[model samples]
Target chain A: MDIRKLVGGNVARLRKKTGLKQEPFSEAAGISQSYLSQIENGHVNLTLLGVNDLAQALGVPPIELFRELSEMNPD
Target chain B: MDIRKLVGGNVARLRKKTGLKQEPFSEAAGISQSYLSQIENGHVNLTLLGVNDLAQALGVPPIELFRELSEMNPD
Candidate 1:
């Protein structure tokens, strides 16, 4: 449905949880702050590599980013 | 860098490989054709749900979708 919003929300949540600002987070994830902002705003499409970078920067599995989906579905 | 193009290329490749039209594939993936089109065109920001749906519809693991990245990197 609202995939952009969903992804943006997830990215924001993860960033906040990591206690990092946009600049540092982007640097850690090897992405530009503008691009990270676009992702957080759901304005840009993401590749698996970008997702992997974010997951690695967060020290978590990529699946963990989507874990909330199961909570909403519960089926 | 070009995440949208990469994702769109992957989706298009997978869809063509399946010998299915956009409608049937969308239906099987439980998504709207417009939405799938957006994804294929790199115009939509996809969530893990959408990715998983496409993966299931294509009869492949999600990781398989990103396997190409390894080949591109090779390091």
Candidate 2:
């Protein structure tokens, strides 16, 4: 299901929807801008802690980050 | 909010509920049993991809792992 890409794309989409820049958002999320950029680019694996931090920073539930995941087949 | 513990506890609970042991479940999830054990103990950080893989192995949606997350205050 390309979970990394799904999460990365959603993170970017939601961050943009909130009108937040990577620098400030990453600061609020307790991560560096470069790391957040890597996450947004699907070039990094985000820890569960990272997911919660980013979700909070984006003013959304962690589940919201997986909004596009229903199309996947777990098998 | 202790996200690591939250996810770890839930993962263990769901795994037990499914009647699968760590060895088989870890194999199905494509992770090492030791790594899964660490995750189950809340001693490891799980990436988004890891979360998805575990959720799929557990036969649930990724969000299900965060079922108890509503009590947290993002702020």
Candidate 3:
């Protein structure tokens, strides 16, 4: 269902909401700039590890990312 | 931050909250049972697509997961 697009969009939205740039977010999440960009662009497949890192960096749980994505584009 | 444990716990909680088993959730999310199991146990990584699928199947936004997780385990 084009989940990548949904995830990418959500990441962008959250990053903006928290006033964090890709670099800082990546640093906080312990991810690479390229990987984070890929996620933001729907160009990568995130592992549970990746999402977990993101959750921690964003001060939320991993599921929060998915929940936000769903809210953004509900059925 | 042991994001794995957090994600795994959240997945388990959600599954239980919805009265769903891993098999049904895997089917709904279009993921494999093994993969879903790993996620539930903090043994696998999750892609944006994976999270999106779970969100869609669970009828919630991606961020809601993180929020719930936070509520479950505050800082």
Q: In lDDT terms, which candidate is top?
A: 2
What is candidate 2's TM-score against the reference? 0.72
The sequence of per-residue lDDT tens digits that candidate 1 reaches over residues B1-75 is 345555666787789889998999888888899988888887765655557677778886554444345555587
What CAPRI-style quality would you assign to candidate 1?
incorrect
Runs in model 3 with CA error above 4 Å? A1-40, A51-75, B68-75
Worst 10 residues of 3 chain B by lDDT: B61-70
After TM-score superposition, the amount by which residue A51's alpha carbon in candidate 2 deviates from its true location, in angstroms, is: 1.7
RMSD of each: 7.9, 5.4, 5.1
For candidate 3, lDDT tens digit of each residue in A4-48?
A: 665566677788789989998888778788888988887867776
Please give fnat for model 1.
0.03
Better of 1 and 2 by TM-score: 2
- Tell me which residue pairs clash in candidate 2: none
TM-score of each: 0.50, 0.72, 0.57
Ordering by TM-score? 2, 3, 1
Question: What would the per-residue lDDT of candidate 1 be over residues A1-75, giving only the tens digit for each residue?
Answer: 344545566787789888999999988888899988988887755555557677678886554544445565587
**TM-score for the second chain in candidate 1?**
0.78
What DockQ would you assign to candidate 2? 0.67
For model 1 the local lDDT of residue B11 reads 84
Interface root mean square deviation of every model, in Å? 6.0, 1.4, 3.3
Residue A46, model 2: lDDT of 82
